[model samples]
Structure formats: structure tokens, C-alpha cells
Target: MSRIIRNLVSLALLLTAMSVQAAPSSFDLVGPRLSVAVTRDGSTLPLEWVPNLAEGDRVAIKLDLPAGQSDRFRLVAAFLRGAVDRPPDAWFHDTVSGKTKGGDLSLVVPKGAQQLVLFVLPERGAGRNAIVSAVRKQPGTFVRAVQDLNQAALDRARLDTFLDLLFRIGRQDPDSVNAASQVLTRSLAIKLKTECLQQPPELQAACLTGDRETLLFADTHSSALADTLTGAPVDLAFQLSATPQGGYGSYSSYIGVVRDILRLFGAFQSSQLRFVPALARMGDGRLTLLLNTPLSFAKPASVMVVGLPAIEAAKPPPLQAAAGVPLLCAAPDTVLPVEGAPLVYATRYAHDMVLRVAPDGAAGFDLPVHADARRGGFVLDRALPDRSAGATIDARIAGRWGFTPFDGPRFKLSDPRVNRWTAAPRASLVVGRSNAVTLTGEGAGCIDGITMQRGDAAAQAVSWKQDDANTIVVDVPLDKATPGTVTLTVTARAPAPPVSIVLPALQEVGRIDGVAYAAGDESAVLTGSRLDQVREVRAGKATWRPGALTRAAGADRLTLLPVDPAAAQVLTAGERIVADVTF
Candidate 1:
């Protein structure tokens, strides 16, 4: 009996081990409890608990199994809509529809399924220990499913009918018809063409009429056709009539009637539909009727029936005679004359006006007044006047009537002529037999004294003595003047061009006073007479240098020093320092 008990206990233990190794049996799973937690290592697993699911909800199942070697075990998480009793080891495996995480498995609960059963297991001849979990449907999924059903139903027959009407209207014009037909054919080829039979009859009729009632349906239902017909009802209608005729009137009459209908319909339609505004003019007067809306959508058939009224011309302002100005005889009446004044009168007839200026000192057909004159009479209806100064005459009067003062005679100033200079060149002089300087205008003039400092001064100033009317002569002396630069300035109303003088270099005769000596010598005295020939001492010598010496007696003596004993000496003690200098 003890042996028998041992056998039974061992058997029970074996059964318990088998139960632990077995996968859970197929069971119904739903949402709200279904969830996946992704780990930092990119491994994902479904929750341990099953969820309450609704129809159309998705469930993601994951299994945490080793990668690469995972293919050795074919694992699947199967969800059945109904309950089933099956062995855990006998669970079936299904190929996952998407990416798997280490033998992961997922299954969606179908819309028609009332319950779901999930199985996690390996394929035939596979290893074990692959854990699978899944997500289940929730209330939000059911709500979305209902919404989708309603939207699908909403996108039906009515929309198709509206698009059909649009297609019909876009076929009237040859070019538009061809273009739309091509598009339709291409769409049909692509299997994207919509069927008119799917649309409701009421929406179809509204689309045919191009009525506003169909707009909302068109917008939501047929984006392309809706965009085409946004503002283009007239054109759309014409296109529809041009299509192969089966319904409505004959082709020619159909066109005429549609044209007439468009015209009549346009009257009620907003101005925004018409492309061009109406314009009218009478006798050069312009009338513009500004339509407030842009007509990018529709174009009118013709402007003749629109009937734009011609605009009347604006009347010109009434003519007012200038104060104290004469009013010459006008065509219809005799006007009184204002003494010592010019007259101007303005009149208007219809779109035309005339401005009349009476003859003051001259008579002419037409003349323009000076633009600068504030009070002059102007003929706005005629050409501008000549600005040149001249005598004006009325030939009928046989005498010159208008004369511009200072027009023909010459005037002279009583002041003496003065020469002006500005920015004159160095060594320039205004007086002393220089070139004649022309004076521009009459003004008080001043003369600036000549300045001398530069070596090029050869010009000198002398007294200005007037000789005759518009003529003056100035005597200048350049002899005995320092050979340097000088400038003369004269101020007057207007200046003449400047005169410049360049002096030749003067050859100076200079004297030297010594024979060459060592450069270190402090002083070497020299005696010489006739040293006035020296323009500079110790010039043109290689090393002889002149030095200041304090002389107690006789002529002031010049000491000399030499840079080297080889330098030439032209003077000796007691000999005159005779130096020929060219000045």
C-alpha cells in the first residue's frame, strides 16, 4: 500500500509540472485593461491582464523572447471571437501581420466578433518560453467605429449627383469641354471616377441649376468640382448644354437659351461673378461703373445688353473778369472794358469749354500766358505761350501794342571798370602792363596788396589810372623786384580769368674766402673785399664750410672749415672774394 501511494504522489507531481509549462487556453479578451509598456532596451510586452474589448478595436500582442534565435520558435498570440476549450500545448500559432518583438504576436478583434480567444505558443518543432500578451478594445474604439460608419454613409449618393452636375456644366465650351472631358477620362482610367447613380436626384437637379443651395454639398463632397464652380456658374451652365445632347433643348437653341438665361441670371447674381465692369463715355467725358467685386469666377456674355448710361460732362467754373480789366466783345454779347487791365473770360458748352483773353496790347488767335505770372490771363484750352522777349502787335490796329521794357535797348553803368581776380596763380599781377581783364558787372571793387615771398616773383603792381570809358591802363614795374613768388587779389561783382607769371632763375655771382683744410679745424680766418658778389657763402664746394667769426678790427672776416684737404679753394687772404653770380 505504501508503494502504491508513492506512485500516485509522483504522478501528481508530474501533472503539476505539465500544468505549469502549458500556455493559457484560448479565452475572450477585451479592452480598457489592454496596454503595452516599452522598456529602455526597446523590448515591449502586453500587460498580464486581459481587457474588456469593443468591436473594431485593435489589440497589440508582444512577446519577450531572445532575438536572432527567436526564429527557432514560431510564436503567435491568437485571439478568437468566441470561447474555445483547448490544451495549452496544443495552442495554434499565426504569422504576425506587422513587425514583431522577439517572437511577438498580435491579433485584432473583428467588428462582428462578440468574444475573443487568444493563444500564445510556438510553431511545430519550436522551442518554448515565449511569453505573449495583447491589448484589447475599449469604449473609445466603439465610438470611433460608429463615427466612421456615419461618415461613410454621409459620403454617398448626394455628393455623386452634385459632382455629375458640375461635370455636365463644364462641357459646353469646346475648349473647356475638351479639357474637362480629358480630365474625366483620365480619372476613369485611374478607377477614381465617381458614379452619378450614387448621387441623390435632388442634389443632381440643384447642381444642374447652378443654384447656391448645392454649394455646401459640393464643397464637402467634390473638392475639385467645387473649386471649379466656386464663382463660375454661367460658364459652367454653358459647358453643360454643350455636352452630347440627350436632355433639355436642341444644340443651337440650347446655346441661345442658356445665353439668355445667363444674362437674366446675372442680374440676380452678385456682381462678384462678372469679370469686367461697365464703362460709358459721352463726347470725351468718361463714366466708370466700379463693380465692387472681383469677377475671377464668371464672365458676361456681352456688354451691349448691360446698358451703361453715358456720363454728362462737368460744367466749367463761371468766368470772372479780372478787377479793372477790360472785357472785350464776346461772340454773344458786348462786354464792358476795365481801364488799364487785361481781360479773361471762360465759357462752357456741353463737354467743351473755351477760355477767352481780350486783346490788351496785342491781338492773336491764341497765346499762352507766362507760367510764372500770378495775374496774367491764360487760355487753358490752347497751347502754351512763347517765353522769349519780343514786341507784340495787333496787325489790325497797324501799330505795336505791347512792348517788354529793356527788351531791345542797351544800358550802361556809370561806375568805373574794375578787374577782379580769384584764386590767382603764384606770381600773378593785376596791374603794370598785364593782359586786359574783363569786368562782368557793376559793383564796388577792392584791390588786395601784392604778396612776395617765393623765388618766382616776377610780377609787380602799379597805380591803376583810368584812360577812357570802359577802359583802364595800369603801369607795372618788374625791374628791381625780388625774384620770388607773389599773388594779387581784386574783388568785384564778377571776376576775370587770372594771369600767372614765371620768372627766370637769376644767375648770382658769389665769393669764397678760403683754401681747403681738415674738417676738425675750429676756425681759419680769411680776408676778402668785393664779397658783395656772393649770393651764398661756401656754395658749390665739396667740403669748405663757412663759419661765423668775431672780428675785432678791419672787415668782418669769414672762417672756413674743410671736410677734406682735397677740396678746391678760389679765394686767398688779402685777395677779393670775386665770385661771378648770375642773378
Candidate 2:
């Protein structure tokens, strides 16, 4: 096994040397059987399984090596944070000269490390810097290879768990089995083929244990799959076993099927059949998804959109797309195609739009690609903005070979007021003072400039500074202005409309005198500064709204007719008056 692994590594290195553009094949990398055991929080993961790593994780990597050839080679482990390679000194190194057929190296996963690369070189060949330089030349290939490795490891773990579940279901009593087993027997079994089961007496015995190879061939090569490969209209089942006349072929040994499934998953993780999801705000302000595909494979045979749980969910619920509730968010048998031209594919896919997660339990929508004369991509609908935070959408595209799943775009919901105000700049402002106000809300950071205009006067420049992501400070000069409305037009960064805030100025309205209600009087007399500015007045259980203010020569006075005349007329010292006044 070690010799085979060595040869595979040699082939990979040779390929890299021959062509800089050559992708590091996962097949070659997988042969090394690079098993990593991550020790985190005092617990060590099982061998050959690699989980997502966090900071402060200590990883133990064991590599199989050819016996006599060990002395001639050195294993270099490179840790990467995205495309940025870690310093050469931080990389792990081990000389493969052990008496045993295997060598082990231990290292902390390190802060911000998202990828790991392991390769063997001649002990005397290139120095560490030289190796680093080569990796820098094609960082994307190495990064992609690492992602594929991690995904393959995770998929293998899942497959093992699935097999374990099957074994448990067989060994345990029907009543004692778990919900997962119950789902398999009650819901999943109906989708299987009766021929595979062979009849009632042998249903559990023959069907549960079937030939994987024959089953895969039967399902994958069916008429529906053939139609899909040829770009014909066919409603194909998303899973292998769920297809018509198809089942997990009664595999005598489960190893072959598991390998096949892992390989399939590996291909999905690779860049070979590239599919990327993006978010776009159209001219009409519609937020959409841009499902970018390579020009060579631009037209997918079929596309399906799956609504996912809040992206932050630690464990998302299993996807169950029945016929009516199609994950595609369309009626059954509906065939949606890519809606952009090849040139649009070239121009649009170049963007670095990343997928974001929507809030948990947020509503999901279908995002299909679209294009016009000037712009082209998936146009996000209004539903996206309405969704709660952390919600995520996903998609599956069927190519000539098989179905490949990709993540859809995400959104962070914002107040709708931000949209209308930016274009017209209408918000309330107070007069007779220079107001230093801190504006805090969504899209506050987008405000690059602020201007204050009183009535029809020329726009006066205002000094404003961004304090944080959601806060901006603006100083409005209104001390000289008389009581009236002022429009504060706020300018956002390019592409966002400027918002106008219309401020109707009113003098301070809080001054108060005694409120008196004579037994024979028709209403109570309330006196205060800016008596006309008070919209409503509340005292004890009695609430009063004045029709209009009638001011005397001495003071501003208003007669308040209580809405509830039968309630208590007396006002407490604490609750003597609570008025709603506009500025």
C-alpha cells in the first residue's frame, strides 16, 4: 500500500512539473491514505476521519511509506489560510526514515488555517522556500484539492454512519429502533423497487441486502437519466435509489457502493464541473441569484433549487422534497433552463460574489438566472428582503454525467424605510438649534455625505462622520431658522439613492401650568408653551385631544375635551400630563 501511495505521489508531482495549469488530482492524493486524527478539547477523533477544524486543534497525521525508500524522501505539510500560505517556518516537516512502514507528525492546526497540503519531495531536492514559491504559483489548485479531501473525509464518515444505521435496524427490535430507522422503513422503503424485494416473505431479507453495482447501473442508466444526459425533458429523481425501477442494489458487500458514492461526492467537490452561486441587485432593485457555470458546460440539462434551513443551524433538517413541494419551487415536471447567453456567462461569473446565509426559518424563494441587453444574471425577487436573517438557499444542476449541488446566495434583511428615504431624503428635523444627531440603522455606513436645506433655501453643507457600521453622526445647523420644515438630504455611496428626511419644526412644547376642570365647565383648560404642537394629552384614565389651540394675550391655551368624560378628571403629580408633540 505504501509503495502504491509513493508511486501516486510521484505521478502527481510529475504532472505538476509538466504543466503548471494541471490540477492536483484527488485520485493521486487519495492513494496516499493520508489519515488525520484531530485532537480537540481532550478528545481524539478516530483515524482516517477529518472533521472541520477550529483554532487550537492539534492534528496527528500518519502517512504510509515504502520501507526501504523512506530514507530518500521528506514529507512537507503546508498549512494555508485561504490562498495565503503560512510562513515556511510554521509548516510541519518529517523525514521519512522510520524502521516501521509508517511515519507520524503532530502539529497544531493554527489560527485561521482552512486548508492543509501534504506532499513528498527528494530529501536533498528543493528548500522549503522553493516549495512555497511553487505552491504560490497555483494556490487555487492546492486550495481546491484540500477542500475535496475534507469533503471526501466527511462523506466517508457519513457513509459509515449510514451503514451502521442499517446494521442496527437489522439487529435491533422493530419497536426499539430509532426514528431514522422508522423513516427508512415507513417512508424511504416505498420508493424502492418491488423486484429488488422479490416478494413479501423475502422483502426484508433480499431487498435490504442488494448488489450495489447492478443497482447503480439500473438506476443511473435509466431512461430518465439518459434523457437528462441528452438534454431532453424528463423529471428525474434527485437521488440514486429514488429513481423509477431503481433501488440500492442488494449489495453482498457494501464497500464497492461506498467507494462509488465517495468518488461521486469527490467529483462534486472538485473544480471540474464548476458551479458558483451569487447575489445580484437588478436595475428594478430585485435581488437575484447568479448561478455561474463554465462556458464549456453552460447549459445544464436540469436545475432544482432546494430551500435550506437557517444557514446558522448547527444541524439542518433532512431535505424532503415531495412532488407538490418541489425543492425547485416550481410545479411538477417544470423544466427551467439557464437564461443567459455564453458571453454573459463569461462576464458575470468573473465577479467575487459570495454566498450568505439567511436567518433560521426564513422564507426561501427560487432564484433562476436572467439577462437583458445591458445586465444579466439571476434577479433576486422582493421575497429575499422579506426573509428573516440567516436563511440559505441551495441548488442542484444536472450535467451530462450527474447531478451536482451548489450553495445559493443569502441575505440580511434591512428596514424598508432605508429604501424610500435615500431616494428623496425626507426625515424629521428640529429647529432653533444645531442638532448633533447619531443616525443608527441598516445602511447607515453607506451615507458618504449629508446636506441640510431649510424650506426653499440653497442646500447647506453639513459635517457628518461615520462612527461605526450602523452609526453616522451629522451636525445640522438650524439655530437661525424659524419654525418650519427642513429637508435633510443624505447622500449614500455610489449606486445607492440619496434619502431626504423632511423635518417639520415646532418650538419646545413641554412647559405646563395647572389644568383646571370646574364642575359646570364644558371642558378642562390646559395651558403650555407651543400649546398647538401637542397632538394629544393624557391624564390619569382621562385622555383629551384638542380640536384646535385658542391662545390668549397672556398665554397659549387649549380646551381639551376628554374622550372618556366619565373617567376620573383628577391628574396625579407623576402622571399630570403626557403629551404627544411633533418636532
Candidate 3:
């Protein structure tokens, strides 16, 4: 044989091998054969739909369950007409006949349909994830997506048909759709249930829509679970103290959502959902005022924001015509510009919307935060304009219209929140006599582990517990400390796209030199160059906190004051030494 012929044959074989390798693992087998090949344990599922019903969009279902797992589980699907209501029976394969195209391998539906069904059947291991690949490619599969606030595009990252949200105050303007549109955006149309202008104070978020089959559900105004967090028995105090702007990192929005979920489980629950400030100005010519939440809301007509009489009484910031760039700031209290102002309004309450993520949160989009597979979560990092470290405002919601606030939080033409992140991230460590080491701002999602090695001293297993998701307290053994400084290190974990950050070794603080004082003592003076910090101090049987410290002589003389008088009780000499210092 000629060498040319041999080379040609080898090239042909290589091409054939590559093509076979490129074929997708799953395939569609839709024809007359109802009992086709089980196809490697139902790894991939193919489906189709044609508009055959009366007055709604067409629907289809595909399943890819493990072969042996669901031997008796037939494909059954159902939907929720409202937030809390659903039909008793599910539509089976018989309800909707299926037809597979002969050679092309496609499931064909009937004709002239108007209604569609999004099955809420997680138990079936079917629906969206099982079929979105083909569905997104199909001509008209009704993609489950979220439209951008700019209305320029839709985000389909998570293929869910709906999300739970709250209803806030609304407004009336030529471009009012932009406000609610901030939270209400999806590739598919949505019906938001929000507060209308029918009454003075809109307290509820349950207004009936015209469609008897469709129900709008949302949490009411007092939805914040702040009270529940205060007495949170769990060591989730790290989650409680975290500020929304500084602690949560990219998943700040997602953490708030998870915190709200924890709130529902906490002993005390509230109907109030937390609200964030949103600025929508697409550059048209009008301004629309709408309160924003991370959750989604629909009902454009029902969403309205009416400032209480107190908003006007606060002497809010004045509205200046085209005053620099309209900057939105989040203040502790609610304030707003006068009518005809082009700003947004939102009040600040101690919502604790911010949360601590693992140190590896930066890579959360891709890999697991830890090598041990101990945790998993996602981050919703919404970029904003000017992070002043004091406030945050996402301007993507800013449309072309002018937003006029009747009464709400103040919005100026010059507030800042973009650079806030530049100086936002900081690391802190508080040490104490109890040998408790508190890690602050250590991780992005969750603090996974801590190790302290004093020179050659065996990498001691310091027992620790999470004060919150972002903070952890590693209680070193009483014998671990000496009179000199020591080096300590930690590793934090966030969700993937995998990120792990190791903080610089923290230098230890030397022993405190002070007059002995009982835990019940109100104050104690220490003359030393080293001061140990602690989050909690226990004296006698009660919990006491060390208050602000005052130093004088060459920064050596220090005074510690106990703030909790209730914890003051007669004690023994054993409690006369220094207690933990609360930061």
C-alpha cells in the first residue's frame, strides 16, 4: 500500500473517533416504541410540546431518573394555582398524549393550546433541570428566565418559574413599570401582588388578581425577623452582627435570603421581609420610586410606595435639578427628597441583611468551597455605583424616567456606594483570658477550620464553634499560652467557583498586668502594653461584657469597665482575675 493511502486511512479513523466522542451522553428516543432502550439509567431525557390545548401555552415533561430508583414511580406532574393552593390530583402521561417524530427523535404535542403547566414535582426528579437543555434550544419552550432591570436581557441561571417576595410602598408615574420591574423581571411574564394606592397605609400583600386560577402571594411589610436574631440560641451571632454592605461579599443578597429562611425556623418569626434600596433611571426623562427586595414581586398595578406623614416631617434632602450624578445612599432612618425629585428612597433598620460566607466565596460559582465537601451555596454579587463603604445602590435598575418620592428614605443626586467595597474588607481577631480566639471578617460564606501552632508545639486541636456563619471562636487550651506572643492562622470556606483565603498570621497579645478584680466588679485598671480582646466575659454565673477601654500613660495604663450590671454579684477569689474582653 502507498504511504499516502495509509495516512489518509489513519486521518479518517481519527475523525470518526472524535465525532463519536463528541456525541452527547443522553439522547431522545421518541417513536412508536414506548418501551425503547432504558439508555444507561435515564441519564439524559428528551421532550417536546406542541400547542394543542384550548387557551394557554403548551407544556411538556421529561424525566431522567436513575433506572432502578423509581421502578414504581410513574411520571406525575402538578402546579400551584396560588402561593398556598394546588390541585389534589396530578396529570399523568395519559392526560397528555405523547408522539415521537420518526427519525428526528422528537415528542410532538397537540395543536391550538393557550395554557401551560410548570410541574412542581421535585419528588419525580423531573421538570426544569431534567429538560432545560432541550427546552432552551426548542423553538418555543417558554424559557424560565429573569429579565434584567434594564430590560435589555433576561437571566436564566436558576430555571425556576417563581420566587417568593414582599410588597412595599408603591408610586404612580408615567414610567412606573420600571420600579416594580426592578424586582419583577423574567423571561416569562409574571403577575406581582403588591400594595396599591387604595388605602393610606398598605399593610398587606394579598390582593386578588382577576384570574381565578392564578394567585399572587407575598410577605407583608413587617417581614423582618430582626427580633428573632437577637435571641438566636444558635451560635449564628456572626450572621446577626454582619452588616449588609460590608460582610456578605458577592453573595450578600443570597445570604439575606438564607438568613430569612433561618428566621422562619427561629422561635420568633415575623411577616416582615427585609427591603433594599433600588435606583431605576434608564435615562428616559422621568424618575420612579420603588422599594426593592432581593426576592421577586409581580403585579405592576398593585405595587405602590406612600410615604408616611413622618417622612415629610423629617426635613429630607432637597431635590436639585440634575444635581451631579443622582447618588443613592442608605441611611439608618427613612428620608426622601421633595416631589419632582429624581431619586429613590429606602429606610434603614437593623435588618442584619449582610451575612458571612466562607473565605473561598470568590470561586463559589465553580467549585465547592472545601475539599472535604462539607458545605455548598451560591453568591448573587450585584454590582453597584460608588460603594462608599457607607451605602450601596445598584444603578442597573436606573431607567430613563424621573423618580419622585412622596415620602421614604432620602435619595440625593450625589450619594456614593461603589468604592465602598474598595476599603470594605477588613480582618479582625479578638483574644481573651479564656483562651477564646474570635475571628471576624475571616471568610466569605462559612468559617470551616482553625489551627494554631506555637513553633514546634504539636498543631494543637483548638476546639472552636461558629459565633455566626462568618465568625468562629476557637477556644485554645488553657496551657497553650505563654508570656510571649504567638502566631495563629486560619482557613475559611465559601461556596464555589472555589475560593480559599488564608489570613496572615495574627500575633498574640502578652499577659495583662492589672490589679485583680472580681467578675462582679464594675471596673478594673490594667497597667500593661498587651490587652487581650474577647467577645464575651463570664463571671460568677452571669454573662458580663467588657466596655470601652481608656488608656493614658504611654498607652500602657488600661481600664476595663463591665457594662452588664445584672451580671454583678458577690463572687469568690477564683473570679477575681481578668475576664474575657468583649469587642
RMSD (Å) per prediction: 41.4, 27.2, 27.2
Which regions of candidate 2 are displaced past 4 Å? 1-35, 40-50, 64-74, 83-89, 97-103, 120-134, 163-195, 198-210, 213-583
Instruction: Note the Cα lDDT for every prediction shown.
Output: 0.28, 0.40, 0.27
> What is the per-residue lDDT of model 2 for residues 71-188, given as tens digits with 9 covering 90 to 100?
3444556666655543445654554535256456787766666655655444454444555654565565455544433333222222223334545554554332333333332221
What TM-score, over all chains together, does every model reach?
0.13, 0.29, 0.21
lDDT of 3 by residue, 289-382 (tens): 2222222232111111111011011122222222232232222111111221111111110111211211222321111111000001111123
Error of 2 at 350 (Å): 39
lDDT of 1 at 289: 23
For candidate 1, lDDT tens digit of each residue in 1-583?
9999999999999999897545221111111111222121232222211112444344453433333433332333322322232223223244432244433444444444443332222243222322111112222222222222212112221223334534554444322432332232222111122332234543433333343322222212234554444443232222221111221010111122223333443443322222121111111121112121222312321111111101112112122233543212111211221111111110001111222232454444422212101112322323223321111111110111111011111111121123332332332432211232322221212122322223444433445433333333433443354433333333322222233333332323333444333333444445443232223334244334455643334233655554444443433345433332221
**For model 2, what is the C-alpha lDDT against the true structure?**
0.40
The candidate scoring highest on TM-score is 2
Rank by TM-score, highest first: 2, 3, 1
For model 3, state the Cα shift of residue 427 in Å: 12
Which of the two, 1 or 3, has more TM-score? 3
